[model samples]
Target: MALNNNRYSCPYICPSTHMQGEETKQQETAKIAVKPENILSAPYVPGNVRPRSPKVYPPGAPPKYLPQPTESTSGDILWMSPVGPWAAGHIDWSPQAGITGVRPVVDKYSITRYSTGEWRKNNQFTLTPRATDKAKALEAETQKDVANTFSNLDKKLNHSNEMLNDRIKELSYWKKQVQSTLNGITEELAAIEADRQRLKGACKILMLPEAISRECLELRTGRYEPDLVRDDAEQELIKEVAIVGEIRKIFNDTLIKAELQIEMIKSTKAAIERDWSDKEISLKIDNLNYTLTPDSNLILAHPGVTRWPENATTLEYWKHYCAESIRNCEDVRKMSAKLRADLMTSITKGGEDMKNQANRTNSALAETIDATEQMCEKLEDNLKDNLQKIADIENLIDYLKESLRNVQERNKCVMTRLHNRNYERPSVENCRDEAQYALMAEAKFIKESSESLQSKLREAESVRSELMKYRGELEKDIACKRKSLNIDKDRCARVRAHMPTPEEFAAG
Candidate 1:
């Protein structure tokens, strides 16, 4: 193997060199990935570095620190960048030095693309470096947003509390009003009870039934006595008068007829006596007819004689005297007989007629007397019946009047009982006063309760007003924050669109 060393030499590449080239490629890829981070960080322009307060811990506490990788190698690269502590800090895959190197590459490329007009002319994805003044402005904007959020929450809480309080006050006021109304109703009921009791007491005071009974009895006794007696007496007097009048008329008629019959008898007896006297004188003249003397003719020529003889001794004169005497005696006898027969007939007929008339009159009188007696008896009976009826009617009337009086008295007693509440026997007026006072007290209670409820209601209204004000303010703040957040989202979308995709530059 040592015969010719130069002629046996072999051509082979080094694996270390290939591996170093692959590392360079990987570094390039990593650098490209870090470019976006560098651009994101570059936009956060460094302002004046202010001293920040370190986190404080309690006694016996350990210091909080982020972890770091201990191993190191030549050309080693990190791909992930660390985030801030406030955002839950994570380790960066790329080293801090590598980020610095890639930052210039990313900036250069971004500038070239912008100049060539390959991106949007507005360069919305390009994160401009924030100046010191701009950083201050962002901090102020963040503080303002926090303050507005807190203020809105406070307003909402206050409005809810106010509404709750107002509702409680309204409930309390209504409760008082109800209590007052109940009190008034109680007073009215008490008044009604008092009135009822008074009326009951009054009804007991009047003893009307007994009085009515006594009055009725007295009226019954007196009602019929006088009127019935008077009517009976009047009827008796009328009957008596009628009977007396009829008897008087009959007696007068009988007396007139009897007197006329007696007068006719007396005239007939006188005419018979005159005829006998003339006959007696003529017979005496005939017995003295034979004696002739001068004085005889004178005697015959006397006024008592009928004629005077011319020859004093003539025989015809005597004969004529005897005949005349006989005729005169016969005529006297005939006249006497006629007078006797006529008188007897007149007396008998008159007596019979008178007796008949008397019997009839007596019978009629007896009948009239009997009728009068019957009338009297009937009048007496009628009087008794009328008296009884009148008594009954009067009794009824008296009973009614007494009953009316009793009712009135009872009513008066009821009134008295109603009034006098303090006394044993109360009057209507006294009862009414007690009832009225009770009612007044209840009314006062109601008024007071109502007033209290009204005051509470007013307070509730005031609280509600404050709550409404707070709600209005909260609504305004929320609206403003929402509008700001919308603007921020639009800006973020524009920036994201400007970012390049990995596949766009990858080798096929």
Candidate 2:
């Protein structure tokens, strides 16, 4: 009825459009507001409609999975990945040898300080061929080269030995020839030696016993060397023979004349023997003095012995006889000695050369042995290094193996987690519903809490205003009290100043 009554009274207002000014006022005056009897009551819904229950989960149901807030998974590892990471490994077996090894010498060998199985990590190490591998690779070439070198050394040694052996034989042959030539040229000396030997045999026993020989020499003379006793013994025996000759006389004239003649001949022979011995001794002495090649050649040219001319008288060759007999004798003795010395030097030269050759060969052999032994030691040390390297490599292998196992275990763990993520993810609709329900509950809680907080905030503002007023009043009161206290303090100061000390009061 009100709407009927107001319908004509109100100006036309566009129901879909907003009104302003007179139309807005007229619309307001003509408005038909339909309000229910109770503002909080529900509308008369049909009996067929059911009331909505509060959002609550069914009892004992699996909890909905709270969705992980999706990060920018397009570039992130929000989800577990099935793929395993690529792992790398390395081993350091290269030699880091210190000042450590064996050093062999002729009499003794020494070893440097040694350390073993010292392992360390390095990023710079790269793969290289093992020693055995490298050695195997070069085995044939090294063997061939070594064989060639050894063959050369052996050939040189063999050649040297052969030359040395042949040279020894040649020197022996030359020595024999030289000895034969010496014996042949020394005929006069040999004759003198024969006479001395004959006289020695006739005077005493053919060979004097060493004790008797020593007595005849060392006891009678100062000290006769056994080696030179033959000369001394001969002199003693000759004197003994002379004593016998003087004591023992023959009665027959013819026998006596023969005995005297025999004595004259023996004396003459003794004189000749004496002269020969002097010459021989002088020759021996001179033999030691010649040193130069020219001197030797001179000795060879002049055999140093010139026999006197048998038919020449001193009157026919006076100057030659007088000068040459004495001078030439001296010259002959010197020359003979020089010639013997030269012969001896020449004879031994070949032997000395052979000896030098042998010495050189031995030296080379020794050097080669030393070098070979050194190489052997080096090879052995290499082997030891290789052993250490292999042991360290084994440790490295174990380390890598452990690392690989760890990586595999980690991968398995990750893959297991990934598999669980794939299999165990909750339904998206259930999750979303649960989330929305939770959000609605949260929103209601926030609204209630916000209203409560706002009320509390208003109360706090009133309390703050009251506290500020009280604070202002307290500040004014404190200022008044401060001023009164200052006045009291001034009056107390005046009273204290007027009051005197006890001594001043007494004096006054």
Candidate 3:
């Protein structure tokens, strides 16, 4: 690529492809406007549409339609083909391939100009041929279209990535909410289980046999005295407790399953987010503004090279843009599919929860009813035995009452006789003194029993207070430890979430 001696003569570096001579040597006269829009696929004049002047060039190199020759070299046009053999340079053509079948042109092939000619006075002649003007135009058009394409791509990728980030966050938030709800249900189930356990213990005691129950009370009270208790009340409480325990167990199982579901959904949601992020950034889309240099494709914009080369490269670039656009469109399609899948999964999970709730309710109710019925049947059998015992006790009470009446009559006669004879004889006085001493001994024994009972009661109360206070302290400690465990679990989860996925560091 040799340059003419005159540095300022050719504003264009000129295209590298060889030039063709036109037979119509006469200067072109028609004025044709080659708009920048006409050259590009789609014209996107960002800030302005100022069309710069067509750069000056030798009359032969520019397209016949661009700026016509404002000035001519006015020299004898040489006649010779371009320099080369088959592949290195030009080929021989007839005069028709020369200046419109009128004058021969000088090229690397040979000296086709047989006669010498007068040289131009001061004007410089171009030595370096250019590629076809159509090629240059097409190149320019491709550059502009590609630039716009890349610009749109930059914005598109950014917007898509932003949406991707938002979706990931939304999934995380939704997962957190689900987990929170799951935790609540789990706590409720635990509380219900504790309550059921306490009730179960109480119910077991209530269903104890009457003799055993009396023993238990007497052992605790240190007394043989009996208080009336109803078999019907105990049976009713047993039935209620059995039913409640069955229901509580059912709820506990259901909540356990629900907690598992929350964990499953959280894991699945995280995978979805990770996969989407990978797919979105897989193209290295974030680096498009730097990696995609549309400016580099602007061969037409190179100094003084606007009207030279032409080929299928323009159409090729067009195809490339279309392909890139399709890829982006596919990304959008996949994103939509992902969102749709998420929606369907949510709806499905909701339906499953409803089903689980209904199933749990039915199972709890049915099991509770069965337990209650079984308990009540056992209680009925016990009640029948208790009733027979009651009848026997009633007969014994009647006989005892008759004996007490006879004894009371005899005792009244004796007391009257004693009262009349007392204080007159030495034997009567001795009996009266002995009876008063026996009464004093009985009073002293009763006071001792009362004091012993009072001491026992105080000891029992003190023990109960101490146990209650210790239980409260233990519960508080347990609550604090549970809170710390939850905080640690959350911290661990956050750390895991911050970890990168496989996509972040993979090579292109």
Q: Give all candidates' CA lDDT scores.
A: 0.39, 0.37, 0.40
Give every collision pair in model 2. 287-337
Worst 10 residues of 1 by lDDT: 112-121
Name model 2 segments beyond 4 Å from true.
Answer: 1-344, 426-508
**TM-score, candidate number 2:** 0.19
TM-score of 3: 0.20
- Rank ordering of all candidates by TM-score, starting from the highest: 1, 3, 2
Candidate rank order under lDDT: 3, 1, 2
- Which portions of model 3 miss their true places by more than 4 Å? 1-313, 331-339, 346-354, 357-362, 373-399, 407-508
lDDT of 2 by residue, 158-248 (tens): 6765665554554344344434333433443443333333333322321122222233323323322221233422454344334333322
lDDT of 1 by residue, 1-508 (tens): 0112222222111113334465466556545544322222322456633555553334553222211122112223422123321221233212222323332113222321111111221232243454698789998999999999978976875675566555445434433443333333333333323322322222221112123223322222342222222232233333433433443344344334434433433443344344344434543443344233334544544475566776465546644653454444344334434443443343334334433433443344344435445544555555555555555555555555555455556545544543444465346634546665765555455455555545554555555455455545444444433332232223322332332222211110
Predicted structure with the largest TM-score when compared to the true one: 1
Clashes of each: 20, 1, 16
Measured on C-alpha atoms, candidate 1 has an lDDT of 0.39
Per-residue lDDT of candidate 3, residues 24-132 (tens digit)? 2321221122223222212334554356666454546644433234422222222222432312123333322233343344436654422211122111234335689
Which wins on TM-score, candidate 2 or candidate 3? 3
TM-score of 1: 0.23
